[model samples]
Target: MAKQKTAFVCSDCGSDYVKWQGQCGDCHAWNTLKEIRLGPAKGSGRAGASVADQRKGFAGALDSARVLKEIDLDAVPRISSGAGEFDRVLGGGLVSGSAILIGGNPGAGKSTLLLQTMCHLAKSMDALYVTGEESLQQIAMRAKRLGLPTDALRLMAETNVEAIVAAVDELKPRVLVIDSIQVVHTDELTSAPGSVSQVRECAAYLIRYAKQSGTVLLLVGHVTKDGSLAGPKVLEHMIDCSILLEGSEDARFRILRGQKNRFGAVNELGVFAMTEQGMREVKNPSAIFLDRGSEPASGSAVMVVWEGTRPLLVEVQALVDDSQLGNPRRVAVGLEQNRLAMLLAILHRHGGLQVGDQDVFANVVGGVKVLETSADLALLLAIVSSFRDRVLPTDLVVFGEVGLSGEIRPVPNGQERLSEAVKHGFKWAIVPKGNAPRADIKGMRVTAVAKLSEALAALE
Candidate 1:
């Protein structure tokens, strides 16, 4: 006979926890202990309900455990998102039987991208969008705003997983899109919608159906006040791919960032600017973010911020002014605060700049929040330029990091950054001290900057 069945669940990883504790042994999320259900000890747990588990007792009796078996490695035909930025972020688009969990703050355009993608697929394949978060009339209004085709796209507003699956069985959709999975619950789970148990149960059923039937499932998830996925942590592990739609509250630009991809690259980002018609693709982002027609102004410099494999040239602006009060202020936006402090010290000591008694304010134009340390050189140069009240050359781009000793550090894939700059019509590139150009892109002059002093001298 099977052991007693229990609903032990971990507050941290959502892994079943039979006993209570101060900390979650798995995943190490502190203070994340909760007894989701009453269950017996681990030895009395019921067997997992799968065919694979039934073979547990036949391992030795079965023909020699196949040590090495041929496996299928080739990827299936993929569906590309109409937007290049979006497609690249999803590692060249959606794979068959993939359950993608996308979580973001309110107004992050999660629904916009998902619906548009479904509409795009509905043109060729059968697609069904089940929205537990929005009513049919609401979705129709939004579809009208999106200029969607009435016949190709199908919508069902349901919150029950059993009913949703039945509709899927009837529709036999090639692609299924669920907007805000937190709203959908299961009949088996007594927990309410958006709760830990409900989200966990609903996600498990959808994931199981997708894997068994090879249907591409797209899920829109919610974010808690702390900006984490609103469901149990295990919900993230159950999905094959996870993306976070991040941006401002007003939604000027949206960043589609991938956290986990069974088939593609990680940390890939796609930038999209919100418009009246819909989310518009920014083909030439550098031109829009970086000032093109501006004269070389001191206290401003351009940088090649690496977003995954792609290099984007962004403008870094710094302002250094004499501290009117005894204590100076340090302010940075779209940049790390700790690194700014380090760079300031470097400028004051190694570069012989008098910034200690001055207030500094730094920003990356166009609302881009860059995390690359490669922005170091540009930041330092911008500080110097701002102090000198001069601007950098309008035709130039800066690429490199700054060391404590005031030496220029080379960034990864410098060649890619250079080519992108050249394609964007940048003429002069101030790179690391000893870096060599990978290819001579015509119309662009490369300048090797060894130190903070050397770069300032060249600009002067």
Candidate 2:
């Protein structure tokens, strides 16, 4: 037998260390190191039965490289999950043999979404949902409650990775849904399930099975306190797609975001509303984020933000108050706090707004997170409105990148933004001078401004 080696692994960031330490060297996390024993890998010259060496099924095949010209020109077809919103985030549909990792907070409905999709996928293909966390009867109850077609879908409640792989070979399923990789463990590994070693090893086995068998693997994952996918950081690189399902637990709305995709566009958003039945797709997402008030309100501005290829009209709201504390608080929800500070500085210096002593708060309505700078102008306008107690035009929409020097910079897809604003009955638009689209939008009147002072002046 080969000599067994022991190593310490950080549970928080999956960094391997030679010895025990109070703090992890890589993640700087304290008290996260755990000791684990490692045996020689499978297919080794000295092994009796290697951990993952048995390649009795499709994984045993090997192929040589072929010439580029010899490859067929046929296009691969994507399988639609019968859910438009899910398909939208997946760049049309799910590709065969692709491995997707989905992470979300507890009660974020990761299981519900996958269960619904698997039911839909079972209509045409052989779909199997293996649950390591929940019982088969519990899944059946959920399927009944969600009004899903359960007859076509198969369910298995097993946590053993070796058993799961053996079942995959016996079933030969095209679509495989693993409730979570964290709970599944291999008997060969002495560490408990959800350990870093267990997660990496189990995921590797499943990924190899999916790639060799041409099966689409959907993995449900847990999120850390920082909202990143749990387990080793390399787990994200091994999969073809990485997704996050996020929203407030109290709110009925949920946002499915694609953080990484090899076959599709990254940072794509899909909107869904929770109901008694199940998750329903939101077709007109612009209406969900925009406030439809007849009269204009102070500290509120409209912004046309691009999510993937779709344009969404979202409301930017800000509140300014006199602070009694030594350092005024700058709080932002759904918007970056650092960006708010920079915008406030620009407003005070260039636009001549007195906001240094006031406490500022900014928010993007309807639980939609805005990460781009295209909504900077609208956010600043909302801050100014709250500070000066002024109400801007309700029908007007604004979008432009605000620089540190208070310059209004042009954003991408200017025409799409303007057209979306017009489609939603907006009469006025304040855009960057450089972003004046070539084609004119009929209903909305566009005013191009180059400087921050010009944009503030137009609010009068």
Candidate 3:
């Protein structure tokens, strides 16, 4: 007989501890340690029984490896779903035998996007959608409401992992979509579905099946409150690609960002707009993110930021007001709080703006998040414009990284940013001194500044 033991596991990092604690030692997440009862050790009498049950639907055998030169390069061709933005994020199209994990907040349109993709792909290739969360009738209703044809598509509503795998083996679909990996369970595991062990094991079986059968597998996952994919962190590492569908709940715009991709580039983003028909690709995101034909208002500035291979012009807005409370508040949306604080300090020390005692709030328009430092200068300028109550030129676009000593640092792809700005009818641009255009951009003027003070003076 094997001895059973209790272990405390951190939900964020999957690190197991001997005792329960308030904070996870590895991930530093507070109140995340959950106590779980472990079964007997591996290799015990029950081990073989559980392992054999879990391996029932998994494909068997491993082929011998071949030399790099002898391997065929064109065995697998990428499959296109006819969605431009979606294909762009995938680095062309979906690859055979590749496992993709996409997670997002509830109602962020994960199911809607996947269903649309399945509908499109079903027209050309054999596509199967297995929904554990919703029934076939519900899915059909949604498809009908979205005006999608369900003739070529096959839908199965099953939550048992083993049954789903059996169906996949029998059907042999070119593309398979699991509505959510969290809702599926296997009888081999005593733990419930969505548990760390069950999620990890179930995904392993499905991924193995995909590899052996050359089927493209798309796994939809749930996300935690912190906007990270739920389940064990190992779940992310087990897949070929990890994608995040990001957008505000009330906003129509959705950003499909690739966090990890084995066959393509990482950090690539595809912009989409949720419409009455379905999710529509935004070919020109600049026009959506930037407000045009309005008078230039205080605390508003245009910034040219790069998302993957594309450059977008978005408006950054800030507000500075007298603090009625004892401690002044620093609020930021679509921008990091720490980053905003650092920029405010640089503004006061370098740009000679006093705003520490006042309440500061900043946001990026169109529900877009600014993660890069290229928007630092524009954010500072917006805050400065609000503090001074001065209106900046509506046609001006600014982009550069602001350093601790108030130096404006050059950003990558300076020429591309300027070109994008010019295309959007921006007449003037403020860039880092060293970031001169490789070629002259037509219909635009470039004013390079090395210091934050120079950038602020350019507003005069």
Candidate 4:
């Protein structure tokens, strides 16, 4: 008979403990320890578990199990999901037998993305979509509303894990997508569906089955109230990649970011606009960002921001005004708030700008937010130029990270930034004094300034 013992395990990090305590020693999370069935009781401490007794069940099976070395890897070619942005996030389309985990907020269009992907993949290959949270009729209705083709795409409405895996084996589908993993459960675990144990086990089994059968699996996961994977943390580790979807509450534009990817670039971001025609990819994003009819005004500057290998030109707008309130308010949207505050302080102290009694609001024109620090200098210049009531030259482009001492700092890939500016027909680029590349671009001149004082002087 197998011996049973008691042990304490952390509910969060899976750390083990000898004694039950209110606080976990490893992760410092409170009340995370729960009693678990352990191995041997007393003398099994030093060697962890006695190998003498360890020679037991599954040993014969383990010795005989052999891994496949000549599996067919190129049997199924990747099916491109129509959208370029979506394809980039997926690392050059879907792999043959890869498993993907997608999570996001409610109504954030997790279903929309996969549904569209299925429709696109169905054009070339047979794709199966299994949904635990919705019925086949409901899925069909949504597909019709989204104008997606349904002839090649198959839909299965089942929640039982056994039945799901059996269907996949029989169908030999090219790609399998699970709408949400939280609702699927197996009979082996006593815990209910969506519980930590059930989720982890379900994901593990599905991943193993996908790998063995050579079916690309896409698992749609739910996010918790705290914006984390709804189930245990280990659920993320069992899969090959994770994609995160972020959107505003009002739903004007949505951002797709790669949280983890083993196949492609990590810095790539996909931009999509929510429209009546459906989620359309904005290929030329900069054109959509510029103001259409507004006159060229003071405090607004055009600068180039790099997103991965692509250079995106944006219009940075700032409104600086005198304040009647004792504490002047400074607000920033689509950029770092603390960094804006720091830039304002530096402008006041070193650049001799009177911003303390000014009410300022800065915006990145479009709904897209800036993540790269290279936009810092452009933003700072826009705010200063706006406060001084000076209209920046339309042919000028500025980008750099500013230091606390009011010095313009160099950012990565300066050459690419300049090349992009030159291609866009910008005659002048104000960059860091020493770091500007001497790379030649016809009809464009690069101006490198060392300090903000020098930049303000040149701009004026």
Residue 399, candidate 2: alpha-carbon lDDT: 97
Tens digit per residue, CA lDDT, model 2, 314-433: 998999999999999999999988888888889989999988789999989998899999999999999989998999888899999998888999999998889888888999999999
TM-score: which candidate is best?
A: 2
TM-score of 1: 0.86
Candidate 4 lDDT, 322-395, residue by residue in tens: 89899888789888888889988988888998788889899987766788888888888899888888889888
Error of 1 at 31 (Å): 4.0
lDDT of each: 0.79, 0.87, 0.87, 0.78
Clashing pairs in 3: none
Error of 4 at 352 (Å): 2.2
Q: Candidate 2 — which pairs collide?
A: none
**Model 4 regions lying over 4 Å from their true place:** 1-78, 224-226, 291-293, 321-330
Which window of ten consecutive residues has the lowest lDDT sum in model 4?
A: 53-62
Tell me the number of clashing residue pairs for each predicted model: 10, 0, 0, 2
The Cα RMSD of model 4 versus the native structure comes to 6.1
Model 3's C-alpha root-mean-square deviation from the true structure amounts to 3.5
- Report residue 458 deviation for candidate 2 (angstroms): 1.0
lDDT of candidate 1 over 1-460, digit per residue (tens): 8664545466457766666566677776776654343333111224664554333221111234444555344647778867888888888878888899888998888888887788888989999999887788987887789786667988998999999998997888989998879899877657678877677767777777776567899999988887788767888888888898888777587878888888788877788888766787787677778764435556777888888667888888898888898899999999999999998899877788878888999998877778888898889888888888876777778878889998888788888888888887789998996665856768888888888888767876
At residue 228, give the lDDT of candidate 3. 82
| RMSD in order of candidates | 4.5, 2.9, 3.5, 6.1
